[model samples]
Target: MATRTIIVPEGMEFIRDELGYAPAVRVEQRLYIAGQIGRGSDRQLVADKEAQFTQVFENLRQVLEAAGAGFEHLVEVTSYLTDMRDLPLYMQVRDRYMAGCYPAWTAIGAASLCGAPGYFLEVKAIAELD
Candidate 1:
């Protein structure tokens, strides 16, 4: 197997602009994704927290699929939050995506995020796939 870095510049400019990393990387059959946020296809942060968390997972799903993988392949995840108080809501939406398979996870409480207000949470994932 070979390692690869995938940059979806056609739709995601913030990868280089904000994080200075490619959108995703494949290494030895695993995909280590950069941090994904609650942004839409239009690249704007959804104003609602539940919607934002939903969008973030959707965005991560897209990246995983782009790398030929799926949610069950995720082995680890790192989550950041501008407001830890929103974790319940975040987890509600997150559980819907995770389907009871809990990956190794780390969460940090933060003062703010890169985008607009109400942008409560951000998360990145590492996936093992074929």
Candidate 2:
């Protein structure tokens, strides 16, 4: 049986403490990262669309790093956006962090995310670790 290990990076303890969920989980060579938003260290949501998209990727990066992984390790990624019109901006910001690493991606238009307005994006991913 593969043992499951919860991943909560150095600065993400509040996720488990307050949200009652692990930011990421590792089972054998696979890591499942939870949905990450555009919130910063203080958990305040970023207001600008472009900046929020960047922050969303940064949040995902933090979870990947916690599992000793990176964008290259990502095998699949699912992005939820409140507005489909923001797809171009999302892709642009995503490209900046993804660079040459290409993973299976799916972007969905969502009515709302995180159960609130102003919260525009949420990203979740699965990674394969060596």
lDDT (Cα, tens digit) per residue for candidate 2, span 1-130: 8999999988789999989999999999999999999998888999998888999999899888888889999999999999999998888999999989889999999999998789889999999999
Q: By summed lDDT, which 10 consecutive residues of candidate 2 come out lowest?
A: 61-70
Please list the C-alpha lDDT of all candidates, in the order they appear.
0.82, 0.92
Task: Give a tens-digit lDDT track for model 1, residues 37-115.
Answer: 8889887779877888899989888888777777899999999999788878878888888987779999899888875
User: What TM-score goes with each of the models?
Assistant: 0.86, 0.97
Candidate 1 global TM-score: 0.86
